[model samples]
Target: MTIIFITTFSEVHADLAIIAHPDYQGGELTREMVKELFLEEKLEFPSGHKAIPANHASGSPDRKAFFEYVLEMSETRHKRYWARKVSVGKKGAPKELASHKEVLDWIKNTPLGITYIEKTKVDDSVKVLLTVAVFDDL
Candidate 1:
């Protein structure tokens, strides 16, 4: 009998760039701060403006990478976490959009919106807080 290995691994890794609206004056956030923002632990910027965290759609690879590397959770766990938060009356997960363009558009218009997107999709309209590499493994 012949045996063939069928592995399912991809070499396409992506870096997620954290971006905020151009009017954002809260300045850069540390990795921990970013984590707190995504985790819904922080709801406002240092400037006291409401921090609205946007996100690429649930199944987007960029979203997956951001959650894994930045937020440090799997998709299911992340959803559960947000669900629990929502049940308590806190804002749920970030607004999930379709594509990078959509995310960029939303961020550009939302003064307090923060999001992680592919570096290449970033433009001058948004302020880049930081760039984080999304590794395939924890």
Candidate 2:
């Protein structure tokens, strides 16, 4: 008797929506602006509203994708960047929440909170600033 093994693989793609509280009047953000906000380089929106960025917990798929696509930096590089900023008396990283639900809830209550989540998870509570395509292999 002979036996054979079959292997299968799949690719998963998701659109990540960068969302903000409904009260945020900053309007849509360009990719560079979004990156600056998350990196704490730009503290306020063009509308003059404070931009408070929220991040998914470290190691989460959303965090990895956001860092890769939006921020255009690897996690290690981001950490180093923050370390250097902090050493020079600059702001540190954004607030990190444990899950999407926590992030959404936080954004809902915080007037200027901004965060990224899988587009399908978005609801009427927040406004989308930008959508990023995230691809992964299974």
Candidate 3:
């Protein structure tokens, strides 16, 4: 038998794009607005449509980058924040999807859906509200 080695490299940075459904009528979103939306602090878009925020699964690279760049919180802090909110029955965390493809598909069919994805995955299927450059190894 021969021995083989496998090497894995972590990403140095990932460019993420905050995207919404193509039909979403809201204007460009500020980081504050995106934070509020994702945290469930604000429930509606500027257009008065109900906002439905989606997230990548916990521990995902995109999720980690989003928390660092956009939300300005560490994963532990985010979990604590949401845990408190949920414990108090105030609100729950955003919908968690598995992959970029799933998020894209969901957002495309949902008028007020919003989520983040790798910048390279962005296309006409969704409208980008913000593009963040995340520099991290998480």
Candidate 4:
């Protein structure tokens, strides 16, 4: 008799390109600041304009990486945290978009919009504020 085994594996790594409106003169953000922006703790840009954050949908792979590497939280926990914040009128979650293209469109049209997307999706339209590797720790 003979025995055999087959194994398969796949890997996906994402890099975050933090982008903002062209007119944003708010300067660079530290990692902590980026975290705050995503968590809705920072409502206004450094220039004093209200910030409208565009985020990937809960199920997006990039979103998953952002939560794990940047926000350091799981999807469910993030949702629960935002729910509680919204209930008390403390904050609101970012506007969730289904794809990077949608997020790019929102950022282009919104004067104060900020979002982190895959590095490859960034173009000349939006200003790059920062870049963070989603798997830097790995």
Candidate 5:
């Protein structure tokens, strides 16, 4: 698992970008929760840079589209919206965020804080559900 930190609940959220899916844990992500969790305290969560689960993969035509749905918008409709922007050169294609290792280094020195929890699983085939609660920041 990975950790993402925010200083205050009211601030805007960073994109919950998926860097990779080496273990294939897929689900929905939202900025509002990330934003509110920042409420007047430091917050952290077990973040995974991966998809929700194969069982829920969107009907979208491509990997990028599927990811944006499951990981970013909580649905696939936005994939086409984001895709159009990419095609027009108004936006660059979204890269998978980065491996946990690269993200760890970035978080270490950055004012915005984060942590990495251990990777785990419950079933042999089902990866552990990514879960975490925040620590109040000093």
Candidate 6:
């Protein structure tokens, strides 16, 4: 399971308090990845949509560019799949984590992988298993 820290804002460098775990709970992220899965595809864009997340201060310009790339990919997928216009990008309001401790708190609380219980035993035995796979949200 992937726990994502997500937030929204109307402007860059402005502060918002809540950061959600599943920002695009329904296949939004997955669709973006699939379309941009190819390295060349990452540069792809659609017609009439040119606005990228803007950075007025030029602080971490690359970060803004990356966000724009992902947002563009997501928007393209959204239009292609649902036949709707997904907003190109939203000003990521300045987001401030409630506290540095909150990150640690979330990490401490989240379970490693996920647990499934199989019941068929005379007594009972606990077994730990390892598995690897890409989890697709879409």
Q: What is the C-alpha lDDT of each candidate?
A: 0.84, 0.88, 0.87, 0.81, 0.32, 0.26
| Tens digit of per-residue lDDT, candidate 1, span 8-122 | 6655466779999887898668878888987878887777778889888879988888878788889999888988988989866778889888998999989889898988778
Q: List the residue pairs that clash in candidate 1.
A: none
Q: RMSD (Cα, Å) of candidate 6?
A: 19.8
Error of 3 at 88 (Å): 1.8
Model 1 / residue 113 / CA error / Å: 0.7
Per-model root-mean-square deviation over C-alphas? 4.0, 3.2, 6.0, 4.0, 17.3, 19.8
Better of 2 and 5 by TM-score: 2
- What is the TM-score ranking, best to worst? 2, 3, 1, 4, 5, 6
Name the 10 consecutive residues with the lowest summed lDDT in model 6: 113-122
What is the C-alpha lDDT profile of model 5 across 75-106, one tens digit per residue?
Answer: 44445655676687654322232333443333
Against the true structure, whose TM-score is highest?
A: 2
lDDT for model 1, on a 0 to 1 scale? 0.84
Per-residue C-alpha lDDT of model 3 across residues 1-138, encoded as one tens digit per residue: 999997666665659999999877987788889989998888988778889999999888899889988888998998899999989878778889998889899999988899999898888989999888766443
Point out the higher-scoring one by TM-score: 1 or 5. 1
- How many steric clashes does model 5 contain? 11
What's the CA error at residue 59 for candidate 5, in Å? 16
List residue ranges in candidate 6 displaced over 4 A: 1-28, 31-58, 73-138
lDDT, model 3, position 1: 100
Per residue, candidate 4 scores C-alpha lDDT tens digits across 66-104 of: 788788999889989988988998757888999888888
lDDT of 3 at 127: 93
